[model samples]
Target: MKHITILVPDGQTSLSSVACIVGSYEMFTRANGYWSQTEAGKKNGTKELYKIELAGVSKKAEFDNGLLTVTTHVHISNISKTNLIIIPSLVRDYETAVKGNKLLIEWIEQQYKAGAEIASMCTGTFMLASAGLLDGKNCSTHWSAADTFRTLFPNVNLLADQLITDEHGIYTNGGAYSFLNLLLYLVEKYYDRQTAIFCSKIFQIEMDRQSQSAFTIFTGQKSHGDEMVKEAQAYIENNLQEKISVEQLSSIFSVGRRNFDRRFIKATGNTPVEYSQRVKIESAKKAFETSRKTINEVMYEVGYNDVKAFREVFRKITGMSPLEYRNRYNKEAVV
Candidate 1:
């Protein structure tokens, strides 16, 4: 049987972490049980496909200052091996979360080195990334935590736009609550597409949501400790309707053009140009949400005169055309 281990982390974890573990366990165990009860499942031997359990640093995981405790099936130091390790979204104070679970982190590394696949949910990617498992690998985390994640793990190809990423034996999902997508993906991979669909209906998770871009709210990084880059972000936000230029920003901030671009990227995980585009697109998003203006009008309001350029940029950032975005989100849109 394929063993699935859900790593229960300590610190101020979200209830979704428990929810994630239960959901995964339920789906896998239910699938096996359901199929076993059926003649086809019995004949095919699909019922004994997976075994699920929770593993942690200790037998009892205390959270919220001992208010809640999750008893584990196995302790990390005791378990020799498992087929898969699922890292649930730990607490948001990622640094403390990592520090508190040093042994669990080490155990995860050992498991990965022992030929087990590692999957991280939301902020759990922080732990995997902390263990250097995600270095040079494409991964994702919750869009809200994108800035912090990028700042901490620069080597990780943090694809914040994707809902899920699978590289080598590691899997990552974009957000904690949206983890159902990744779960379904895993279910489909281990079982079958048909089983995944059936499970989705049972769990009420939407299938085939490939991008987190549409739901993402673009908030520029301002906590990178660069005052000049902060000023540049403020300028871009303030002057979206104006023709904002890199040279202008660099000169305004008393930095050289190439050097300014580099600094801005380092400070915000986005080049000056990319940052400006994000600012403009975010402004356009607000317009679509609050105004009855046409797409072209909204584009122009955001200082883009060329229709094609505006549409392309809008689609790139939002994962939908201007019209589609407006139709979906704008309450004022006409029939």
Candidate 2:
């Protein structure tokens, strides 16, 4: 049987806040029972697909002046190992979560070295990233936390628009409650697609939600201490309807071509050209959401007259064609 250890971090706890632990427990337990009764398991003799347990560094995780407590089954030292380690979303301050779960992080690294797959849900990606597992891998965190996550872990590829990321047996899901989609993906990968579909219907959760881009509110990456990049970002946002080129931007910013590109990328995690496209697409997204503009009008308004080029960039950034985006998100279109 596959050993699945859900590590409950030593952080604040309340019935209202412990969604990760409870949600994962319910999914796996219910999934195991589903497998047992389905024809999909007829090929295998054993019915139980996973041996799930909640392990933690502390005996009892209490918070709010001991008003709440989360009981753990096994201590970090008790378990020799397991097949999978799932890090749930940390509800408390991320730094606090990391500091309190230092032992759990070490254990997770040990388990990975011992051939176990690690999956982090939402902000739980922070813990896995802390372990240096995501240093050179593609990972996703909640969009709201993307800026902070990128600031802290620059080496990790923070795909803020992706709902799930799976690289080298290390998996991570986008921020917030999107962990349900990640769980469904895991169920399909570990068990079967039919089972995953069954669980989706049972839980009333949308299946195959591959991108969080539509929900992401782009406020521009300006937290870095680079004033020039901030100015460049502002210029791009202001001139979305104007034709702006890298050469002109660098010259206007009074920086050398090579240095401007490097500084902009390092500061904002996007190259000058990529940043411009994102700014334009963001403007276009707003137009799609609130305006009844035709695709052509929106395209031309965003300074893109080439049908193919605009469609391609729109799809690349938002993961949906312009028309599809308008149809789904436009309140005016719905009316």
* CA lDDT of every candidate: 0.85, 0.85
1-335 in candidate 1: lDDT tens per residue? 67888888765576767777777777777666655655656677665777788888777776666766788898777778798888888878888888988888998998999999988998889999999998899999999989888888889899999999999999999886788899889888876777788888888889988998988888888888888888889988988898888988988988999999998888888888888888899989888888888988888888899999999998999899989998899767855
Q: Candidate 2: lDDT of 72?
A: 84
Candidate 1, position 194, lDDT: 75
Could you give candidate 2's per-residue lDDT for residues 25-64 as a string of tens digits? 8888888888877786765767798888989878888755
Candidate 2 backbone clash number: 1
Q: What are the RMSDs of all candidates, in order? A: 2.1, 2.4
lDDT of 1: 0.85
Off by over 4 Å in 1: 34-46, 62-69
What TM-scores do the predictions have? 0.92, 0.91
